[model samples]
Target: MATATRRSSRLSSLAESISSSAGSTQTPNSRKRKQSPVATPSTPPQKRQRPAKLPAATPTPSAVGLMAHATSATKKPTNPMVARLADPQTTNATLLSPETSRVITHMNVAAIPSRLPQPSTTTATLLEEANAHLIKVDERMRPLVENNFCRVFSPEGLAEAIDPFESLASGIISQQVSGAAAKSIKAKFVALFEGDRRFPHPSDVAPLPIERLRTAGLSQRKAEYIKGLAEKFVSGELSAQMLNDARYEEVLRHLIAVRGLGKWSVEMFACFGLKRMDVFSLGDLGVQRGMAAFVGKDVAKLKNKGGKWKYMSEKEMLELSEKFAPYRSLFMWYMWRVEETDISTME
Candidate 1:
């Protein structure tokens, strides 16, 4: 009976200790626990919130834009030709012929100043400088300089003293003809002008019949070409002063419009007539042959795709000639000599 009573007392003490521990651990609001609300057919779901975007970055300046800015900052002076053309009185469209007007309208104003010749220097000084430059730059040119003296700058060699009209007329007559034949025809043509005027004036030539021009060994087409050239001169569309003062390219644009005056003819005029220094004629057979010989290229072996013999090509000739610039006219004069003489033999 005493053991049963003691067991009941211990059980009561254990139950009281457990109750006190649970009461000490519980929160003051434990009786009011919060619950998440369930979604119903009548209720809408909440949307998610996103982070805000940052601002865009600025771009760096481009090369072209920088170039444009620099160009504007350092403005170039206006070309004299451009300034002259800008004047209504100077470049009157109504006063100009259709051809002249067209040429003027299409002119590259920015390029005019660069193309114009600088102030004249003595021909002897020019030749001396060119000779030294060519010999120093190219070993092949050494023998050519030693063997031949450049006479293109000499009074007798230059056409500066000759009438521009006569020079141009001579060029037209010489086309497609041998040197001897050309000289003969030019003599006959000048002889038609009667008493001692050297050569007929443009005014005189303009009115003459094409049949009269043909009497001097000219073809029908050549006769027409000369007559048309004369008319251009007579009309004041072309003049000696204009040609003398104009840039090399300007002279080309003006003359190439005339009949029988192609790029080759204009190049000859620039070289021999105006005595321009830096001119090259890729079309001249003599130049082609000379260039081939100079570079040790055998024309027979240098054939095109068709296997036909070809001389130095225009591209190759241009690339080679670039080394002798500012004196290429003198270089071209020597090329003619290369054909007549064996330059390789000379020390």
Candidate 2:
């Protein structure tokens, strides 16, 4: 009985211990203790960041040069619509949305030299004047005018009136001859001078034998013209300075006064030799044909002969050329570039 009582006391003590352990435990639904979050100093939420913008892409000078040469190698764009579409300025304005244009304008504002004030007044003035004239011509012939003719119209030393006697002589030699043949003949003509170099005067030409001039490939008629031109020059009846000072009419008269110079020759001299800015030549078959082609007209009928054809008449040429006044010489230059189609080439 004593052992039993001791065992029962042990059991009671064990039960009390179990109850104290149960009282210390928490239920799953109870809230967790809020230990102050280990004080990592809070950083203010970063303002929403934006991506960096790229700088405008302007072509380098060398890159632009390469692009220009490559562009030139391709055949010129012929369609007016295509030409307009190819231009960045026109394309952007015509095709892009307003917001896109604004973005492009902002990006390219620094790269565009057109927006910058120009310092060279002379070039700008000349180009502005030429463009004003060309804009009128473009209205009539958009396709031809839009395709590049700047090089054709650009001022070149080919038309400088440095020496009237030499210039006219060169023109005479070049008449009805291929450029290569004319060059060879001119060299021979100059060689004759070194052999007959006694006097440095145009009168000196009088003493040169007709046979000697013919040896340089001049036909009998051309020989006579050269001698007569020299005589006029020696007499001081014609001078480069005088021609430079004279009006177009006076210059034409003075050149015609020479025995061999015809209207075509005189026109060539005025337009190419004297650099007359406004002269136009109706007699130039090339110009007539070019104008006809550009105007989209048949230049000639096959049955015609002796210069009578459906080709643009001299009166029409003059009237049509009026639109390019003051820059007609440049217009004439570009005419030579027009291709001679089968119809245009017919007699």
Candidate 3:
């Protein structure tokens, strides 16, 4: 009975100790705490801070003027020459005709300046005026003008003028041959006619046998060309009086249609025969060499490649010649002088 009683007490004591140990390990706030709803005064939502506005930009007077110019309803020029002249940057060259421009473009010529200088009242004569203007524009031209004296306007120079037929025929004969050889051939050609005339009339030449013309040192093709030119003259398709009164463009149009009369030939006739003032020929090798020399280019290096030069182009030639406008023929004469060549021999 005593053992039973002891076992029951020990069991009771062990059960109590386990219960107390578990209670000791338990957290004081085992349940989750509820969040408090504090009644603090609610602040108004903060507004976004705006950036300060910048002041409007004021345009400068020059900018305003440019804007006005841009908006203006001014009429623009239709012609290229006129348009170039309207530009303030353009300062030299005469206004070329459409025909002239076409030829230049076809030849790959340099650009000519569009604006011509106003005529000076200080000079007495046209030649004098041209001289003064050329000197004023290019100082290099002073020595050329002073030394050469522009005999092209003098009576002695004018006295050397031949008729249109002679001039053209002479040009044809002179093609691809030395000056002395051409003179020799021309002498022989003139001898073929019975009359004492300096040159044979186109009427007399039109009916001559090609074989007979060949006896005068003319190539078979050249003979045909000469005959064709004669026939045109005989048919009244070309006339001296008409050519004399026509403008340079008209002259170019008329002569360019003739057989064997190339642009270079026509240009030569205009410069030496017609005495046209504003004409220039980039095809002339003498002129090219002279121009090359004038601009400080090495003349020996200016080799002819195909139809163009090694150093200078036709376009460059035109640009270089632009400053001597309205008197390019005279300028060409002086260019020959620059090379120390006799311009008369070229004729």
Q: Give one digit per residue, the lDDT tens place, for model 3 in 1-347.
A: 12222322232233333444448553322332444454546955455434243221111111111211100111121322211111111112121111111111111112333374443321124466667767887999988898887654332333232356655666677665655676688789889987644467788889999999999999998798888888877787776655545667887888889987666556656665554567787656557667878889876554545633434677888998888887787788788678554344333
RMSD of each predicted structure:
40.5, 39.1, 42.9
Model 2: how large is the Cα RMSD against the reference? Answer: 39.1
**TM-score quality measure for candidate 2:** 0.54
Candidate 2 residue lDDT tens string, 119-201: 33221133335555666766654445566444322222211113455556665666555446766876777677675422124
Worst window of 10 by summed lDDT in candidate 3: 99-108
Model 1 CA lDDT for position 7: 24
- Badly placed stretches (over 4 Å) of model 2 are 1-128, 141-146, 150-161, 195-201, 298-307, 340-347
- Which window of 10 residues has the lowest lDDT sum in candidate 2? 88-97
Estimate TM-scores for all models.
0.57, 0.54, 0.57
Clashing pairs in 1: none
Evaluated against the true structure, the overall lDDT of model 3 is 0.55
TM-score for predicted model 3 compared with the true structure? 0.57
TM-score attained by model 1? 0.57
**Local error of candidate 1 at residue 156 (angstroms):** 5.2
